[model samples]
Target: MRATSIILPALVTALFLPATSPALAQMAPPPVTDDVNLSLQVEDWVKAETARVILVVDLAGQAGGVNRADLLKTAAAIADRTDWRVIAMDKVSDSAGLDRWRAMLETRLPEGRLAGLAERAKRASKPGQQVRIAAVRFEPTLQEMEAARSALRVKLYARIKDEIALLQQTFPDRRYRVQSLRFNENSGGYRDAAPPPPPPFIPPPEIQMIGDPIRTEVIEEVAPANESGSGQEDKMIVQAMVSLGAFAGPTQ
Candidate 1:
């Protein structure tokens, strides 16, 4: 029998997928949930006072060996000596080379102090322990973010309250209460407040989040209250939704 090969033509068809991937699971947040909700964008308006000053200590491939732990300790000590407050000493992975020890410091000083802080840290380095300020940038502190979110919650609640009050006044008979509220961040995540809501009612709703593996709520929701809040300079908007799950019967 003659050898014959059957060539099957490849089928080429376009595959359709969602324009944007589905966001993470949504969840109700505390503090804000009690306030009310929407795909709302509230400005944190926090002063960009906080600055992150990163100091990197390169201990990779050196003729003079140094203990990694000691290097980190030395780096932290050096940061403390600077005008900045030492936030933490973190290990940064360098895929191209060995891991590096990074010291994170913060300051509320004027922007001009960044360069001086970097320079001072470099000058304070000891033998086999070189400290270099990798970067100095202005950002919001955890406290600032918390404050902004807190402010946003108040705003959301006020808006909701005004609307509900108006509606109740209009009806004059029906009673409306907030059943659930959710803020699903564009980052697809959110955080809850500490000291759980006073008990006696229902437990807080479960918050579901679908966001980047490394979630950053600050970058997601908070923004600096700059002069002209436009474009990239515009504040981050936290989107939320309110559920009026139950409506009591008309008052007798």
Candidate 2:
């Protein structure tokens, strides 16, 4: 089944929210560092199934304009060339917006797929810094995971980094320092994916000797024991018959 993708609305910094500075300050710190942290988190948005990437950009201080529109445009352009599903992220300013956001996420990214992260995001946002989060769900077909990781994934991150760099240059007063990170979706931290599953197990074939009663050959020989010539030793050789029975395993 084609897994459903929940595209969250891109959020503006706390400056855009209606909350007072004190109230916004009461909110929890950003999930990532306050610096310009840009990373990708690939999530299994359908339980243990389909996966997608969360391109999170965290900035410190009151940001003037992060240029989300241009960032999104660059993402769409990259998607066209890479065939990845990249989308802009959205923010929630109040309880009503939060409710609607949760409803939309639950309806789309159902069954514990992405609901937890949404809640966490709500908690992590604070007035001290601005955080921008986007998503990219590459082709979920089983065969495309590798392609997504190898080609599309790199392009996705590069585009994001370029945007962040441009923003830093344009708004030097903001002092944006875009951090390069390797994101782990599970822990929501900077790290690579876990080791892959072990290879499939194949038991050895079960062989039973049958219809081979007539078989054995032997040879005997005498040899000197040692320089002392204490005694003579006998050497014996034995062989078993070669036969065939009902086959079970692959012959090729």
Could you say which candidate leads in TM-score? 1
Error of 1 at 105 (Å): 7.5
The lDDT of model 2 is 0.32
- How accurate locally is residue 129 in candidate 1, as Cα lDDT from 0 to 100? 51
TM-score of each: 0.47, 0.18
The number of clashing residue pairs in each candidate reads 7, 7
Q: Model 2, 106-203: lDDT tens per residue?
A: 01122223333433443444554222223323223444334434444455456555656676676654444434444332211222454577464442
lDDT of 1 by residue, 36-104 (tens): 333445544455564555444544444344455564465555444345445454444455656544433
Whole-model lDDT values for every prediction: 0.46, 0.32
Candidate 1: C-alpha lDDT: 0.46
Distance (Å) between predicted and true CA of 130, model 2? 65
RMSD of 1: 22.2
State the displacement of the C-alpha of residue 73, model 2, in Å, after optimal TM-score superposition. 56
